[model samples]
Target chain A: MENLDEKFNETIKMGLEIVKETEEDRLMTLSVGPQHPGSGHFRFTIKVDGDYIVYCDPDPGYVHRGEEKMCEYRNYIQNIPHLERPVIHDSTNITYSYSLAVEELTNIQVPLRGQYIRALASELNRQVYTLYWLGIYGIFLGHSTMFMWPLGDRELFIDLLEALTGARVTHAFNIPGGVRNDMPEGFKDRCLRQVAYFEKRLVEYEDIFYNNPLFRQRTEGVGILTKEDAIKLGVTGSVLRASGIPFDVRKAEPYDIYNEIDFKVQYMKTGDSFARSMVPFLDMRESCQIIRTLLDKMPQSGEVRAKLQPNPKGPAGESYKRVESGRGALGYYIVSDGTPKPYRVKLSVGSFRNILALPYLLIGSKLADMPSIYWSLNYWPVEADR
Target chain B: MSSNQSNTQNGSEQKEKVSESVQTSLSKKTETITLEFESSIVNHLVTRFTDKVVQVVYVRPGRTKILVPPNEIVQVATFLKDTLKFDHAESVSGTDYPKDNQIEVIYHLSSYSDEKLSSHVLALSTRVDRNDSRMPTLIDVFKSTEYHERETFEMLGVYFEGHPRNERFLLPEDWADIPPLRKEFRIKGR
Candidate 1:
């Protein structure tokens, strides 16, 4: 018995020494890859020390097709179709900024009715994008029901956009100087009814998803990005507003007819994963109100497009214009040297800016909180790469 | 018939004169307001760094441009961030002027804290020789510029001094060609 006790003590001492050695080199590197369902065509390498992430290196550009370089090869109008490809679901808003910049460069004044229609399409597209984001955020947190609900409701807006622009997604409806066509007959009443119904559905979302104890427990305070840190990191869109800064391009810059419309920029002061997710939901509600106002105030009858020469060229100048997309402030800087094709076109997307905050937020966070923290940044991978 | 034509011509002439006068006054009014805002910011910048500021132009009502020497970019950026409260860089874009043998890098700076300046975008630009394009980094001053500076380095081949990670970010790791945004780097069959 004495011999056995001595042997057991020796084994225990050896085991502790092995554990200490492993702890000294315990960081395990993980590649959340381009193939990851949660990562969405983007990859990041994270080194984990036990359960907490010790270091994070985000690797974007897997889907980069040189959109900026491609812009140089195409004419102004031809650029619209491909430019919107980066954020297809929010195509109108993406192209809206480009259109505004092009209009400024060429000195084309869009008629009042055209401006109203453009704003309407933009607001509708914002709803489509936020819903898609909300659905993905839902599934990322293992809420399968949420994934189905928002995506299913998104089809309603898609249908409206199809009616307005003739395509379901990638509606190349917005062009420089004006939209492609006027609103079809009886479209206003149809949009109003569908939007009103969509508002009711939002309450159900709050009950099932937002207020759910499980969702709240996983998301609330999981990744807290302080206001100071948020600004320093250059995050935008819902992420910035979530951090308690009420800066919206529509409110601040007011492109097109947005200045005339009355709507509140919904924001939260929590600056956590939950607040980031919730701000988009609140923005959708505000969007519904804006849509109603737009339809009510639209002119009775007017031209929707300005006549333009084929392969139109602008004088030598540069114009930068920004509009509030679902992700954030999307701006296009166009430099023209009195040519049909732009000399240089630079697209500054919100996702690229917001992704900068990932390393800042991911470090010192538990590995389990990765999805909640990452997706809550409202990052669309394709747009970021572009 | 001659009297009618002359009468119509006289009427058109008077209309043109009235419209021209109205247009001039309207433009003058806008110019005064623009000058007031432009002079305040431009004058302040010129006085602070008289020789560093190469040129100043009001791009539009809300957009302003300041061209500074490449060596003095960091100082101007620091002053803009600390004193002028241009807290963030919205975008950093580079244009290759191959004809001039220079590359122009523009930083579109804006503010969030100052409500009055929220709509304004101050473009702080600098030009460097295309052969050896190098400029100081603004990462220390505006933490938001980390990714933007890296992108400019990779895209335009403008080496940002003191940028910690000046590597291929958006491009493939094995990319051996010239920076893709350069005017000389053409797409296939273009």
Candidate 2:
């Protein structure tokens, strides 16, 4: 009877301990999870002291399909479909980097016209991606009209890409040697008209979203990532450029025909949320200019693709190539052991790098500023998780 | 009066010389140079740390690989950051060589601060034993390498010494099998 009484007392003590408070109890933990519309297939745990966030821990990989591991099983050509899936809206740029690395590995020279057409598709795809991001960013800030405008304008470019690649989202247009198809007949005039219309629409976006006093008040001085901190954190694309570093992969390390093309690297001196949001818009404007230049400079006629065996294999070597994708610098590091399948493949994405700055920026900020700060970093969670 | 005029002339000449030197140094810092196959950057790194660098080769015009011992990675990374101005790590990737019984970790280093070196990507790599994979972390030198190192650790089971967060990054909390990137860890139905 005494032993049973002692066991009951111990069980009660354990239950009491579970309810006891510790240092962590002072702060309430909230999960901005995948279910949350703002979080978007990613989650982060944050410790809040009332309205202020004290700690942030980003938990990615909810959408991780083990892309790097999957690359080993599939042959070079077969990898394109799934590889482009991570960032489907910006499919061309994702595969463009892979194709460049593969071509370097196999010594496949893309034809002159093929190079121009590839650049054209890449520019069109950039508009599609940025517009989508802008639309989502608008809804995040509670501006529904801001959401509608960019998405509606995005269809113009999407139509152009569909005509060129024969797919709406998953172009898989870029292959190892060259693009899957040449520009369709009348593609040039269609692209020019749409791009000109798109440029006019950009001005309206500035009026409604960017120049709004409410939008300016929320984002102007918030989540300031200084130049030094941005470099130390290794954030890329608009985030890096917004912090005053004019280091575009196209300009810094031009791949294929990017060296021949003349376009300015758009950047901002201020590294605040406002600057980060503005940089991508500026980049879209620059992309339009680039598309015009590429169209003008493209050769009149030439073969689009290089002939290759069904099972293409390269020498025992490795190659790393980077392309300026919509999100940022999407690079592929491929290792080949003279086989049809790659030994190892690593995709170094900008979204992954930019997400590192989240914890650093989110702490000490109000809960209301989370969406503005988070979306301004131009982070795409799926790509980061991949 | 003539002597005073001569002194002023000498002073102006010295001022011009100083400005010229400053201009030259500025140009040297920001000048965008084409990265040749046998570039001077590779030669400099090889010659500077001849003992630590096991092998060095030009993978392509802009990409160079420098292999160092696992033990001396921190030292080499520091030199690359401070002296060579390879400001940031673009990516940290690992490859498992089951035949060689080694797992190689490669840090693709590039520059943003120094425009002259911006075009070049210097891959600093080290190979550790597959079973007993442990290498000193470069996070102290390159702060941006923290997440990349964490990802590499969880994926490959390579322990990064001195790295605070080496736990599961991308993998699930209940991951029980071996690291997924390892050659032995096969994807089902392959």
Candidate 3:
């Protein structure tokens, strides 16, 4: 006390005040979903101080069926529809990937034309499904008419798909070596007509949704995932593409008959909700172009179905086949032990990664901003939950 | 990708720099890169733990199946997320090898990169003695593991230690004793 002068006494007082202010911070754990309307099927609890959610813990598996366990009991053929149900919107991707698994296990070749049609059907269904993402994006933003138009127009593509595979959502189209059916009568003509119709309607889609002020305001800069943040989170597909990564499975690691076709790969440099939303929307048109090339270039051949029964010789192998589903890089990791059924078939699902990215996107935003961010993502909860 | 991307020429000017310091280690390879790291080096990985041998098949290949012991399931999972850079849990699956009397619980981890897409699988496998059915809980590492571990525990009758919230995740919430995914859990038609 004797050594300290008036100046030293004031510095001590300032240090004491700093410690008092530091003690004012607070943390809380608020669970967001598993049932909440905005957060989807899984739940995430975020610890926060007012608006800034600091720690986000995602608790998924609300829909786990132990399907892999069930797959062991079911025969190889019976597993297609079961796998499709996990992410129902992209059935062709699942069926084709699974079919590749069975074929890779058995060592059979799907006929040339059959492979082309498989790619054609998958990409065609992709356009309609891409439209599905767009419609959901619109509805999430509260634009009822933009919601109705693309969805209503999407029926044209779905109708074409129905004629080819005899079902709407889960066609179970691709079998061990090839597709279940060939393109129906006048299918190419109808497909060409649908393409023209979409070309005309695309102007309206741009006018109503893309150019709309509300849609832009809601998504333009929301949920900005830095490229580094995305890579670290293990994000894939359009979400990663939007972050400016140019890697596309179609071009980088082509599967099916993709290497034979000539088409453009769509990407976005800005990693935001708007960029993420833009991907499937553009891929829809690119799908149309690919289908046009297929109609012109499809090889003239025999039956679409390949060796329709169990392989007699029992050859076993494994391959990680990937395709550009409307979403992103959809891959099937197949393992076989020379059996009719897969020894194990594992999938690296796309939507699961997309689903988890929401927390990083949601943290600082308001509760009201949830739907805009959620819908813009086009992530399916059952996909992650599975 | 264009010819520009395929080239390996070094021109160092970028808006976002790709470096060794980035959280999730990034790599781009020309082949279907398959690598086998020495166990001594692998033992030092973030996902590595005691009593478990973490073999990094490829630092970049994106697919891995960690060999784990029954009791140390929780420890390995904690090490993967907290120590290793594998931040997000992708999916959890179980496989019943009736022949071996052992069940494998696979935990898939997705990397957080806009860097590269890779998967790290941790397989916690143990023999189901039929007399004593028990395994450790991994819910602490991956919050999502609660349901996956519960369903496996229910249908396959594998027990989990310290399950935070263990209830049915797949079958109807009120349904009795696992609704049949195992070979022995008989269904009439099959």
TM-score of each: 0.92, 0.90, 0.70
Please tell me the TM-score of chain A for candidate 2.
Answer: 0.94
lDDT tens per residue, model 3, B71-186: 66565666666655555554455555678777666666544432233323333333444436666676656654444466567656666768764555445556675435555675
lDDT of 1 by residue, A142-181 (tens): 9999999999999999999999999999999999989999
Candidate 2 per-residue lDDT over residues A53-148, each given as its tens digit:
999999998898899999999999999999987899999999999999999888788898999999889989999999999999999999999899
* CA deviation > 4 Å runs, candidate 2: A1-25, B1-38, B52-54
Q: Which residue segments of model 1 deviate by more than 4 Å?
A: A1-24, B1-35, B51-54
lDDT of 3 by residue, A193-304 (tens): 9898897888778888888888888888877888776665556677878887665667664666778889877779788888888877777777778889988888776777
Q: A307 in model 3: Cα distance from truth in Å?
A: 2.2
Per-prediction count of colliding residue pairs?
Answer: 0, 0, 15
Q: Which sections of candidate 3 miss by over 4 Å?
A: A1-66, A310-320, A335-338, B1-94, B101-190
Tens-place lDDT per residue, model 2, B61-103, is 5677878998888978888898888888989999999999999
> Residue A352's C-alpha lDDT in candidate 2?
92
Model 2's C-alpha root-mean-square deviation from the true structure amounts to: 9.0
Rank all candidate structures by their lDDT, best first, as comma-separated numbers: 1, 2, 3
Lowest lDDT block of 10, candidate 1 chain A: A17-26
Question: Rank order by TM-score, top first?
Answer: 1, 2, 3
